[model samples]
Target: MAILKHVAGKSADYGAALDYLKYEHDEVLKKPLLDANGNWVLRRDILLDGINCEPELFDVECEMLNAQYHKNQNYDEIKTHHYLISFDPADKDECGLTGERAQAIGMEYVKTNFPGHQALVCTHMDGHNGSGNIHVHIVINSLRKLDVPQKSFMERPIDCKAGYKHHLTKDYLKHLQQSLMNICMRENLNQVDLLSPSVNKITQQEYYARQRGQINLDKLNAELIAEGFTPMRTKFQTEKDKLRDSITAAAKRAKSFEEFSRQLQAESGISVKDHRGRFSYLLPNREKYISARTLGTSFDRNHLLMLFESNALTAEREKQQWSVADPIAVLYIKSNLRLVVNLQDCVKAQQSRAYAQKVKISNLQQMANTIVYIQQHGYDSYDELKKARDELSAKMSDARNTAKSTDADLKRLNEQIHYLGQYLSTKATYKEFLQANNKKIYRSEHQEEIAKYEEAAQFLKRSSPDGTIPTMKDLRAEKEKLLSTRAVQYESYAYFKDYYHELQTACQNVDMILDTGHTQQHSRTHPKRSHEPSL
Candidate 1:
């Protein structure tokens, strides 16, 4: 995950920011909250507010602030924070930990390492990355207590040190790193060093310039051309002939060292040996040997010379151009369409299972109620009641299976939807390519197909008797209805089952109680006869 740090306030020093960032790291309960772009965005401001509030008052005050912000902005208040450390979720594993959990872990780590400082940790999950990564945001409060003296906020604050102005210094950054390292060591987590921030160091142009200087494009093109081969610029290719022409032109322009060699090999069947004992196509009548630098490429003569001597260039080029017009593109498009289909299938499966679960739960509830009614009528020991209890138990097991199957179907449906989303995103370019090639035909076909599938999927999305996808409240109502039905069935089964067991236990107890009472009565009536016993 990529980690980013930003400082707030015009006069903010690195030290103060670092201290605040560290404190925020410790105080926030969840890590890496996702933003609209699906990147992890953590705010330091909310963390600082959380830390400054009394422990008992933190949650309530935060909730009120959040509520007020939402009422005004319709979004979370944390987005308004001045300082933030954002993380990219593409770098993380699929543990499904939410932003809250990330914040909690980060905060706990900081609290254990740094004693008195207050911090807010925000964690986020971002789906924007090619590989989803989880990121954490740690925000710390820069200002220390005004009344506190001598001791830095890094140490435990005494009762007398309630209102001191604590300023963060550059040295505090060092302390922050040490604390983070300590936590990492204790927890066996990966350690990162932010002492020298890498983001602000270089410009993109400078990096590109350096990269361009390392490649000898001119020499490579010439060599390929001389071997009766052409350099194809796959990026701009529209047709096969165009690709062939582009390669032919580069071969004919044999002015540089590489180009001359390439042309000579194409024209004359001559091969020559270099100083390094590498074989290259030699000039027909020229006595002097040409080095790669004569072509003005920026590599060492030996390295440039090696290209002509090697056969691996063709293989590498082929690999690079593999996806330019391959069948894989078509296959990917088909796969994406299949995914859309699968999602429809899943929705249907989930709907069917949900209905089945509702029915089974209802049946179980009814059976439970029936058993309870029988026991209540003083027919507790009836043989028919025992048989009904056993039958109901068997039915209940079937209902449980139905519920489990419904959960599985729902999970599958969700997974299919997620996969379809990913497939659409990844193959977006291919779809565009197809449209560009056959605009009217492809559009008409895709539009019709998509419309049909959407209609079918919509049916499964319905959550009410009106055949509409229900809102949260509507869904809840449906759930309650099913649950209420199930509850009644369960009550009947439980009542009868419990009654049957109770009767058996009572019968045994009664037999013992009567025997003891009879013996006691006999003893009272005739003491000698009681001892002698009437066989």
Candidate 2:
């Protein structure tokens, strides 16, 4: 899951933002790490770029812009707004989210959302806490450097103009979160509903506290080991950690708000309170209640209500299911709600002669039900019949269009896989030739391999300009998935086509029946339908 966070800097020093992006900061000391040479140490790996300003001269440019616009003079003014996009670590393996690809995506996001700002777009392969989650840090000067076109995320008219400072709004943040979700989906990366609160939100202070406490505990255990004494506990849990665990365990089992509160109090000695439609918990020793925001969104009032409702529904469904089945036998879940045991249960559907001539149904009874069905669907009138036919035709067209798109995707993927296989097959000799003492002689000796490799290389370059090559495993899996999807599309297309033809045939039969009924009304050979299907 990708998470977005915004932090505003209050410092007047414009250079510090760029410095932070370039250097590794020690969270324990709250300062940048310095080498023996008395200079800030560069981070392990990063992809840094500038937006509307030179990255190396970012501080100078921001200062000059501030002087020009007469902004950020006050000590309390926010100098920069830092936005972080942290991606799920699993994305590296699942979605092939390399640092280069993530950085490119970050750059595109910055260009589209923060075009007018002097920004630093930086990506780190290893996250701040060494979680190995690829993340991007975008630090932009609070002041806008150029006029930008109005966007959906923009709130006020002044938001478009140059020299105006950036302002964060609820609407803007929601838009950013939604937009990030879209990008993740487009790239086939892992993502979540970021607009909703996190299930477990550990603030920076809590995270660091846990880290420090664990380190101290490990040291204490080491001393005990040296003294040849057993250490009872190896793990350290903060108060909030204990609170979160207790709440989570209780919330999962409790079916209602009252039950959840009672369980929490009984098991953990934590009192749960619902105040003004929000939920909070008071730890045993704590004087104040910890707000749901601190614990996570899962413990909030709305989410709790939803969870309770789900539990109720599940219990109801199980009870009804058990009532209808043998207690010792496990029953299959329902796909269709209606269960029919006899024809009489479906009167109109059972086929009773009133509809025989109305359509080319199997029997007189079926014919009777066919006309009943037509009347029930409001297709007895000419206009309604014509409308149904038109709608079915449109649906048939849609099926065809969708199938075409799926086919095109499958074709392109197959082509790319073929090119990839060829490239991999001839890669060894080509690489050896490149690294040879005399490359010209090596290339001549391996002419066939070089030629084949070059042909494959050219095709692959055109296919993926970003040098994105899916692993053979990934490609094979994708091919299997697309094949299954193609089969489903084929089935859908066939179903729609058959339905379209059947409807057309029924309409023709109905027209013929109407003409005969009009011509023979005076003959007294047949009586009108006594009962019609209730609409």
Candidate 3:
């Protein structure tokens, strides 16, 4: 936020100019007051003869004032004034005002803070986006006699460059800032520290970067290294080749070290080890090559190890348990889930837009109907009816544009949904690898048995008339069917076959218990027994 102030007008027309200035910008028009003539007056001055107003430049003052204020007003009766005042838009809200709201607020401030005198506080927007900034043009009526002695303008020549000397001063600006700060505090808005000038100046990019969590971890590591410490890398790769590939991939992704480390662990099972032997995983074994420093930036093995060690200690203190689940599998599932959710949200937003557009079209149609009815009934003159028809047509055009925008939004949403669905299907194949690595059963020994049980369950679920519980007869039939359909091998499949039946029975029992009032505790303690004779 920045502030710029200017003053224009002689004492006689200062009141009118101030009044007109109030109408210039939306924010300043709302200010409470514009004068410093009363008891609450912060400061005032009447330079009179000492105040130099070049008669030749008086026209310039009128022109400037008219350009900002009276251009749209009845100019014949409006008197122009030359008053000096400093202005800044950033402090608009601090004065308990903003946009159109500031106009009233500014007027009140002038009346209460500087009574008897008149002034105008105007506000404006600047930059690419319309960020409102307000500056006040406090024009005091010079004709109004002041109880205080006028300043000797001869002793101190009027500095036209310094607008403050003509009327407002540096102290006045400080007072205004203080007043605005108080208002801000009362309103629970952010208040700039007047003691620190730097607090008032921040670029838009800096503000946005801070909001988006754009951290400079490299700088942090450098500072630490300067203190005789090395930053560690906790991410691991499957092999030296994989590690090299990850480094290359990370550079291509342009991801931060932390983000890359997380991505690697999600894509690959290999975890990086630190000096203390703590570990974090890296991405998969890809053929890509990346630079070492670029991959982990300022992080090295030692620093990573230290971090891992610290985390391990914390986990130990908390009695945290590690899962056998592959980090990559979990990451894949989570990433896919996020994609799905994002796509869903986008779809919903598009639907909402479509609904809004439909409503707008309906409203426009109603307006058109009303206009048609008026024309048919001869309720209005031809010109009036024509105007009404034209307005309705314009509304219809706007509605069409809105519909087109909604269509585009819907198309984008559908594309995202399709992409997410495809990604999910591709990732589903990886579930087999995940189950093989983490499940209690060995795929080599139990894959066929598990598949049989899954098939039987699906068949029962689909074929059962009333979805009744599987009976002993049903289980025996399923077992017999499996034994007869499959060719006998040298190794007996009976053990695994029996185990699969037991698991299915247990699942059915659990489901039955869950339907009843029996708790999971009881179900866990009462697993189904195998009907087969003991080996």
lDDT of each: 0.41, 0.78, 0.39
Per-residue lDDT over 344-390 for candidate 1, one digit per residue giving the tens place of the 0 to 100 score: 22445456767555544554454444345445534555465445445
Weakest ten-residue segment in model 1 by summed lDDT: 332-341
Backbone atom clashes (below 3 Å) for every candidate: 50, 3, 59
- Predicted candidate 3 versus true structure: per-residue lDDT over 1-535, tens digit per residue: 3222233333334334433332222222323343455322221211111112332233345445444433413434324323222223445445544444544444555544443232334433231124434433444332222222333321233322222122455665566556655654664544555533431233333344433332355565565467433443222222443455643454343324464465455444334433343333343344343323333422344444445566556666544333233211111111100001121224444567675555545544544444444454354554544443454345445555555555554454444334334433433333453457656555455565455444544444444455432444234434433433332320123323333333233333333334433534665887646862221
Better of 1 and 3 by lDDT: 1
In model 1, how many backbone clashes occur? 50
**Ranking according to lDDT, highest score first:** 2, 1, 3
Could you tell me every candidate's TM-score relative to the true structure? Answer: 0.24, 0.53, 0.20
lDDT of 2 by residue, 1-535 (tens): 8889888888877788888888889765558998999988998789999999999989899889999989998889998998999999999998899999988988989888887999989998867677889999999999999998998788898888999999888888888899899999999999888887778888877877887898899998896567443464578889988888888887786789898888777667789889898888899898988998887887788888888778878988987887576321222222211111222244454464354223223434444544765675556686677676677688678878988898998898888889888879998898787679998899889999889888877776666645444556456656665876788888767766766665565565566556546646744765545573331
Between candidates 2 and 3, the lDDT winner = 2
